[model samples]
Target: MSEIPVTPLLDTVDTPSDLRKLDQSQLRQLADELRAEMISAVGTTGGHLGSGLGVVELTTAIHYVFDTPRDRVIWDVGHQAYPHKILTGRRSRIRTLRQGGGLSGFTKRSESEYDPFGAAHSSTSISAALGFAVANKIAGKPGKAIAVIGDGAMSAGMAYEAMNNAEQAGNRLIVILNDNDMSIAPPVGGLSSYLARIVSSREFLSIRELARKLARKLPKALHSAARKTDSFARGMAMGGTLFEELGFYYVGPIDGHDLEHLIPVLENVRDAAEGPCLIHVVTTKGKGYGPAEESADKYHGVQKFDVITGAQAKAPPGPPSYTSVFAKALIAEGERDPTICAITAAMPGGTGVDSFGAAFPDRSFDVGIAEQHAVTFAAGLAAQGMRPFCAIYSTFLQRAYDQVVHDVAIQNLPVRFAIDRAGLVGADGATHAGSFDVTYLASLPNFVVMAAADEAELVNMVHTCAMHDSGPIAVRYPRGNGTGVALPEVPELLEIGKGRIVRQGKKVAILSLGTRLAEALKAADILDAKGLSTTVADLRFAKPLDVELIRKLLISHEVAVTVEEASIGGLGAHVLTMASDEGLIDGGLKLRTLRLPDVFQDHDKPELQYKEAGLDAESIVETVLKALRMNSVGVVEEVRA
Candidate 1:
């Protein structure tokens, strides 16, 4: 790792309060060092790179001006918190970020004194900051509360709702609208354009000042009417008059990158602001870095890379990732079927739909971060006799749970969900883990949930969902590269609710779900060498489980084990429920469920996390042997292939 040049101003500053002591010129130099440190650290750790780099100056300015420990600053979506973390007494631990037992990638309340409110999901900062502001008021403590939210985050309905409530409350709050013109992808919908128009309007200030002066000089009774007229005039000229109507004192269109502009604007707002104010600060997404500025979205989050070349370190060549496999399968399916279409919520590239979008531009839709709209939009398309595949991350899909239940499931819409990142996602931590989708979707009516055990199975599942026209179907796959299994030339759809027994044995049976099949196979081999033959079955569908196969296994085997990569309420829980409902446990067959525990697992390498959770080959072997009441076998004992 290349050593970051330690500047005198940055060296003494261990926390935000320490940063407050530095002069503006020194702070500017510190900002440069912070950016360099962030780029270098992320180049080594491989995390959300560009967002943090963009916010280096903003973060430094905020910490310098604000009271910090007393004055709460909430960051929306938390992706831009790397610099904040580094400045807030975590400089030494910067390299350990997103690693297991290390500093989290996002704003974590437990990690530092300065991070008063933790956030990962978008459009939540305003609401959280308002809550803190209200509490401060109640406590009779005079303190400033600021919410630094992105233009992309402003699209969510929750942000509007919070703004409405904050306006009604008339609390002293500052909302910094970070107008970066992009989220993970280029922002979508009418709001994005409206914001752009309002921010870019050159004549807003001169007109607003004249109107305000005229309103203030009006008679007391006519003041309200004059203010309304001023608002109407502004509305006709600029689009953000809707925000003015919401009762906030709207300010800015200031240059967020220019320190001279930002410093004075922020100071003025801080000194004179009484009610909730929205400062629209325009900033470049990837401000400092040349390559990042050129391709902001591509550099939003990156793997370990060369700082000079901006090229990611070469990874070992292997089988295609599950995401790539799904994308290819969907594209092939779409080519075969004219009605088939694909949709993603601002994540076409992340979801591997870039290829699909290229092949069928008209058929593909990038809906932005509005997950609620994306699900219902897919439903609307499905209602019109179109086969819509809503490709979304499992973590992000949780945002549209209500929509999924109401619009898709209750109506029984044929929307195929290609749920990527359906397991422990390393580095991004708990906020991005694909842990709860299985549990949430399984409980919903008319929802068919399936997990892929490998790349081939994922392809098969995608093909199956595309072919099925009955109801809503979801096929979830994990992050990272797949098992090195050769894919079938022609994709084949498997029978719905039918599971295949991969390995047959005499005494005990292990029923696996998702991509943990290989681990189960390894466990079975380990057991077989110890004179305990184990049967392994891959339960394909979680919703309409193969009861007959399960019953047969329960009757034939003395012990049954259910394994999955999901949380407590997932595949294992469903199996236990089925056993209870069928009264299968009356036969005295011991059942053990192995899945992710209730507590949130820290960010670690997927294999390491699996081993830690006792879901790896060795752990699975140990679990099975212990369940069978067998002695610990020697590690050197080899099983016949």
Candidate 2:
């Protein structure tokens, strides 16, 4: 093992309780050490760097001031909880973040009592914290719920919804709006401690009480006038607040980097609030580190990088990634059709819409973190006879299911759904995995759900969606690189409900959907080697269900199998339903479906996750051999061995 760097101040602290024991004056040094330690940990095991760095001082302040584990400190998105994890007795295993059997990248209730709510999806912290606050109020428990949410995360409607209902949660709720995007956390040239002390001082409250008492003695007309003047003055002075309208007492846009301001402000909010309070702490996204500070988004989610230079380790160059393929393909189609447009929900870069946005800036819309609005907005564009490709990660697309069902699918609009990250995404675990999109979308009427087998197929799918103006269509693809297949000079539009056979044989048939076609072919090769004639078919559309092609495969072959990178009730389920309805199962025909397990899986390498789910080449072979009751080379043993 490499030598761990000496962190004297950080090493002295094991938990938030230990942090509380230190004097107020020593907190700045502690926060400094904490930031260094968090950077070091993330450098070792790459995860969210900028967010965690941005909140180092705030995390330290919250822990130092609040009685956590009892008083729930719910972190929104948990992207900024690396420092919180280090101070909460998970320091020893912090280096194993996002790895198999390691500490999770996000907060989890199972991981620690301190993490009262588990979160990876944004805009959920305020709602979860409100729940804790209300539950504590009912139980008469001493639990204060503090939700530390980023300003970017506040774009989601759920945050505003929670804030609207916050009064019911009583005064035990605190929301620290980490406004890091605006680069507002500037250093206070020595007056920080004095200003913070003045706010937290008892004289401030005495002045408030005295003013209220003096106001009560004034005549009714004068009192009303004074109250109006005070509200107006406060609004003018504080610039007003939407959260205040929602019943929260608005506080500063203070320097989050300043420990003097953070400690006293947090102390004041902890004691003074009899209703929900929102403290807008403005900080830089990537604070302290020169590289991270210089390039905020680049360091937001980094891989293993050089600590000194901040140069991330790049993956070996290969075929173009699925995301790039979709982007380029969409760009080509958009070049041909002026009506084509792109939309994303706070993930312009992640969904590969950045290039499209550049090419057609007028047509591309990045609806910041608002999935529901993105879906309905795309539907509106489609209704106006425009080809709107709403590109969203499958996991995030789930958030707009109601809109998809009601506004798009039900209305039968021509909205094209470019569903990226359509399978288990490594290092993000089950919450971020795109497992259920097929089930949800396939079940919807008038929705055509298709998945690409490789880069070439993805191009065709993009063109197909662009040309087809019948109803809503979805094209799902995996996260990483595609098979090194040669690109077609020009993409051809695929038939709506189609399955193309890559290999033709007899005895057994392996039907695949999405990127699992390669694995199905590999399984077919194994079956052929075992003296069993096998066929491989790429069932492109999960929803349309190529009934005729499926019947041909089922009738021609004694054994049939459906392989998909989706959960139950997807392609396989649809096939089974089609086959059963057609009475194809009455004969001695064997059928099987291979899919992701029902349980939520933890983060690991993509290959390992596929292997674990029994969706890999070897697993396909094993499943086929087991279904046939053939002891040819003992499939499972040979693969496992």
> For each candidate, what TM-score against the reference?
0.92, 0.95
- Lowest lDDT sum, 10 consecutive residues, model 1, at 183-192
Candidate 2 stretches with Cα past 4 Å from truth are 1-3, 183-202, 206-228, 632-641
Residue 210 shift from truth in candidate 1, angstroms: 12
Off by more than 4 A, model 1: 169-171, 182-225, 232-239, 634-641
Task: Give per-residue CA lDDT, model 1, range 1-641, as digits (tens).
Answer: 44566666678889887887777878778888888888888887888887888888888888887788788899999889999988988889998878878888889888887888888888999999888888887778988889999948888888988988996334458888887874322333444434433432345444655667777788976888887776776555443586787777665555566665566556666665346777776677777888888988888888887787788776888888888999899999999999999999878988988889999999999977789999999999999999999999999999999999999999999999999999898877788899999999998888899999999999899899999899999999999889989898988889989999999998879899999999999988888887778999998888789999998998889778898999888888888899999898877778998888778887887788888777877777777666666558734344458
Q: Pick the candidate with the highest lDDT.
A: 2
Clashing pairs in 1: none
Per-residue lDDT, model 1, residue 450, is 92
Q: Rate the local accuracy (lDDT) of all candidates.
A: 0.83, 0.88
Model 2 pairs whose backbones collide: none
